[model samples]
Target: MAHQSKRTTLGEIGEHAAIRVIREECPSRNNGDDAAVLNQPAPNTRPVVATDMLVEDRHFRFDWSTPEQVGIKAISQNFADIEAMGARPTAALLALSAPKDTDVEVLRGIARGIQQALEPFSAQLIGGDITGGEKMVLAVTALGQLGGNRKELRLDAARPGQKVVANGRIGWSAAGLALLRKFEEIPEDLRPLVEHHCAPRIETNRGVIARATGATAMTDNSDGLIQDLRLIAERSGVGIDLKSHAIFPDELLCRAGKLTGIDPWEFVLSGGEDHTFLATTSKETPTGFRDIGRVNKNTGLVTVDGLPPRHEAGWVSF
Candidate 1:
């Protein structure tokens, strides 16, 4: 089942059976072997592949996010990368490394989360591996397909005079994280933001829309918006000027900012992990996307309304 599992802790499960339990308990389709066999892409299609890793304490915390939520976020983030390149995910492999003292129930929860994340998309969980380590770590490799001669939304394809468009929530995860760090009893109205921080729901079809709508470049806003756009700016050798009024915080983010004594613009401008779709289009903005900025001639610069933003440059891994 992708939702429930037997509740046995890691200490009770013992060391030798950890991998075996993971293989047996984790959900899959045509899996549970030394390796996985995947179907080739359909005719007139190109394959897309992406990987993302989640480290305990570095990327997530059990006290803040449930085991199931961590599992969901791990897979969802990887899927966001696949879609960012304008591809449809077809299969996934999850490799996990956790400590010997870890709970088997946590492993089951992660597996269930992975399966649940795949439910909305066409991808299948082909296989994975489990092993002992210093802490919990999850590495996911997702394989995708771009079909029908639609061009890939490469980051370097951006051009001057293109309109930058965005779809989905901006700064929600950051706002949620702020709440989790500061408040013990989160307000009911703001709890959803916190939940989003734990397990985000991405619109998997947005990348396809960008490809079909003549988008030249695209990326997911995993880092802060400006930081992520800078990738396109660097590769395409164009500047991207974001409109503050266009991407500025909504009422909830404003409320969170007021309560936290931080600028709401910081959340909108530099907050990371929202996985919102960002694209540069020469044609009219897609139906689901809103025009947020314009591509300009300034080389490799991302500005907010013609000036550098005041927030930090998104999430830094080092």
Candidate 2:
């Protein structure tokens, strides 16, 4: 859908061609970010739209991440929102802001990240805008097609006896951030976690599987696990008791925690940027999902190993 001189900077080419470089790198269905009609949803399916914005330093650091990684992270988060609705992302619009002196190669890399990230789910960029700003910012709006009724995936739909199931990586991003904060040169093995923090992965087709297997309620773990689960419990008038055995920190996270002197459970329980999917299913988990616990009648209570959390469970933007 959407460069020229070797090592040219944005100041050299100006913003117009900088836009062209991004367009040239990303795959597109329309001429550009315009009134291009998207593919119609499958018969009887409704459209799902989600947006996400990322800011420098707060969301990502240029020193810690490449422009490509930022692009990938930006689109992936928006796509996760669509996935939470049990929908397939089909199109997207990107809005980017940067200083005029920014390097053209950086824009190319960001576009490349967006291009590669959309490959797994077969989505395309339709339109976007670029502007001069004080900080590097990326805003993405994604459109998806839901093959089922919207009410089926509401947060308040969890019922007692439903199994609490989850899929996707957890804690990896937070662990990565910790390592980045503490170390100048990251260990080779820990680099995957850092990579994940930069461009969180979305397991392909798992959302579709959850929908097909009759998910009752679903959410993506953008906030910490306990904090997000509390939202479901509060809204649905139920409680969620998680089994520590089911979601204990894995070997990589344990290693990271040991290195940083931070308990691995802290990462596992409170880490949020991983975009892991949490859902309420029946007794059997859908493919690619693991049963973590069960829903109960006690409303507004989320417990770990049968006890309330020892500390605040998630990130607060305020």
Each candidate structure's TM-score, on Cα atoms with residue i matched to residue i, is 0.93, 0.94
Candidate 2 ranges with C-alpha deviation above 4 Å: 1-7, 149-151
Task: Report RMSD (Å) for each prediction in the order shown.
Answer: 3.4, 3.4
Pick out the ten consecutive residues of candidate 2 with the lowest summed lDDT: 1-10
The alpha-carbon lDDT assigned to residue 307 of candidate 1 equals: 88
- Checking candidate 2 for backbone clashes, the offending pairs are 1-27, 1-28, 2-23, 2-24, 33-127
In model 1, the worst 10-residue window by lDDT is 20-29
- Report the CA-based lDDT of candidate 2 relative to the real structure: 0.86
lDDT of 1 by residue, 1-318 (tens): 679766676666765566565555455656766788776557898888899999999889998999889988988899889888888877788888888777777887787787788878966778777777898899999888888876799999999999999988999899999988898888999888888889988887888888888998999899888889998999999999999899878999999999888898888888899898999999989878999999999999999889888885689898
**Model 2 clashes, total count:** 5
lDDT of 1 at 136: 89
